[model samples]
Target chain A: MANGSTLLVGIAQGIQRPSALQRMLPSATRRVLNVQLTELEHHGLVSKTIFAELPPRVEYELTDLGRSLLPVIEVMEQWGNTHRTALEQALAGNLAELPN
Target chain B: MANGSTLLVGIAQGIQRPSALQRMLPSATRRVLNVQLTELEHHGLVSKTIFAELPPRVEYELTDLGRSLLPVIEVMEQWGNTHRTALEQALAGNLAELPN
Candidate 1:
């Protein structure tokens, strides 16, 4: 769920359409989103529903299992935001200290 | 914190020594453990102390941040245990249904 957390969390927040998810995760490739969605579906964390229309539409929603993961992911997201700078500096420092 | 969670949680459970952590995470390589430990250290999730002995002994202890991550990881671990079979079956089924 590392790479997939952003997608999953966005879906949990009611953004189900792929376009919306793509907008939210600009760095994510279509293939990557597909693969993450497939993994989430496989893990029972999310469900995919296809709508029959002039153009087919696909939407994703969190299953109960997926909902359960949200709080953890939320907490992790908060932690990441809170410590992102420190983590960046630490890694930079570590890299700088590495032997030539 | 995904891969590092195992090591962090193990340390939170009073398993501090590297050798002991390695024992707990048998599948983890020493390099992986070192990287995780360094990241955790950088994140302020854990701290390392070295004992000057016949051979230097290293130990890790969780910071408040690291301790906070434990509950989330514990919940995730429980969910994984609970849904292991369903998840495995789902993936296998998905794979089986794929076109040749």
Candidate 2:
């Protein structure tokens, strides 16, 4: 999955805390993930809450708009999975082996 | 919309020919569009047809799988449109002026 989609799915699936998200998407650089989260927050798709406690708790939750996009994302994911075989072959980038 | 989405929408909307696609998405480099089209075809989302004419003609049509994606694309587009205001503000990147 694309980084953005993965991040959104991670958040939607309850990896709202920053550290948890980092752990969930270990492949994604922390800086890149933070930027994507900020973009998501700025676009009003996700809401960020910061606690004033000593530890400074922070969490992210999908806004109504973000929730609404879940269906679309799900459909896209399904499509990707359904075509995974052909997509992988395509990504392999050796079309000479395609149907002769 | 992202380049991939735009290209898919263009093909879905009958801008099937390469030159026409170029015209429809003028900002997209011809090479990049070709690459995207090839990827779409590779993934089985689109089928290419080449007519054996004196000058040769090529066109693309969404496959059944691709057609199924229309709803997702439509929903995403609708979401983008609905959140255009906030999204534009987000893109502008000046959060200090946000609601106080």
Candidate 3:
């Protein structure tokens, strides 16, 4: 949740074309997603493929390295879900409500 | 890796007293580590305990949720080590020589 990159990488866990990704994360600007994709690509976590057609089609998918990150991300997501209440209390700056 | 919290969580995988953690991450300031520890505690991923002793010692350990994150963090560490070359090239801003 801290880094936008994880969200992008999570969405790209499965092979997806650019347009689909854009639609999936409508709130994110194309530029932001593009930057994350580039970073992931550079890190060898994601790969990009361009299809030759009337208009070039681009698809993004996780590499072995990228796929390796899913288990971690999944755990993070699970933790976030399981502890949503505590996290919300913390975020609200209500320290007193937190359990010991 | 982007968020300092992950690094902190990774370090907290095993029970560690503050002094031990400080030794493990010598470069990090005490304030920074404290902030991260607070965040993790708030999120319910970590728990803290105080011992009634001559020095009033304190210890920090991962909760079940925190321990659950180990598998994911392991994968991330593995991925980083495996793809160190591509990541380094990207960081160095050398676009060429990157495998396709």
Candidate 4:
């Protein structure tokens, strides 16, 4: 899910990378994120620059456009955390109503 | 996509319904939205009450929890509209770089 990766990157910037994503996301998803990062760089949403080393190293940072999305992601995080119980209850209720 | 439908309902609460969703979304999706609205009612994210009519009628309204999500969806809408060009460019560039 490219869209999922996009949203994840938007959430990951300036935050610790979640262990769940690292452990649970497929290798193909990691590759997709790499590609998306490159595209985001090309579109000025993120930046990639080389650093001095025997082998070149790079860092990914959000550009201004990318930074603008932080508020949106924060809102999503807040919503997820606050509504988590409600969501759980809803999910449970749905399951309970399911036919055997 | 239940999540997609949830997001769409969040977007549609205060705004007029978009024709694209009405027409392009599958009937199954519409049914899902109806179910979600009912669940949302149970969770107090939305409210539904009977209205006076020969055949029962109901109108949906967001409760406090639901209203809280509007800002998040607005941010997403803004991001989508503002980045539409970049997204298009990224998609087009990806296509152009594809091997023949």
Count the clashes in each prediction: 0, 0, 1, 0
What stretches of model 3 exceed 4 Å from their correct place?
A: A1-15, A50-57, A67-100, B1-15, B50-57, B79-100
Between the candidate structures 2 and 4, which one is better when assessed by TM-score? 2
TM-score of chain B of each: 0.86, 0.86, 0.79, 0.58
The best-first sequence of candidates by TM-score reads 1, 2, 3, 4
Tens-digit lDDT string for candidate 2 (A1-100): 3666777888899989989988877887889789888878876678899999999999999978678778778877887787677667655654665676
TM-score of the second chain, cand. 2: 0.86
Q: Write the per-residue lDDT of candidate 3 for residues B1-100, one digit (tens) a residue.
A: 3344454565565636877777666777888778777777766667789999999998887866666666666666776787687677655653675576
**Stretches of candidate 1 above 4 Å error?**
A52-54, A78-100, B1-3
Q: With candidate 2 superimposed using the best TM-score fit, by how many Å does residue A96's alpha carbon deviate from the native?
A: 5.9
Q: Among all windows of ten consecutive residues in candidate 3 chain A, which has the lowest summed lDDT? A: A1-10
Residue lDDT tens for model 1, B9-95: 788789999898888777779888787788788667788999999799998999776777787678678777877787788788777
Candidate No. with top lDDT:
1
The residue-by-residue lDDT of candidate 3 on A15-64, one tens digit each, is: 37766677667777888778767776766667788999878988777767
Which parts of model 2 have CA positions greater than 4 angstroms off?
A53-55, A89-100, B51-55, B92-100
Model 4 segments beyond 4 Å from truth?
A: A1-64, B1-64
DockQ metric for all predictions: 0.47, 0.47, 0.39, 0.32
TM-score of structure candidate 4: 0.56
Model 3 Cα RMSD, Å? 5.3
Error of 3 at A4 (Å): 6.8
Candidate 4 C-alpha lDDT tens digits along A15-99: 3233333343456466665665556655656656677887766556665676766666677777888898876776687677778
How well docked is model 4, in DockQ terms? 0.32
lDDT of 4 by residue, B5-95 (tens): 3534644554323233334445546666566556565565665567788776655566667777666767788887888787677668656
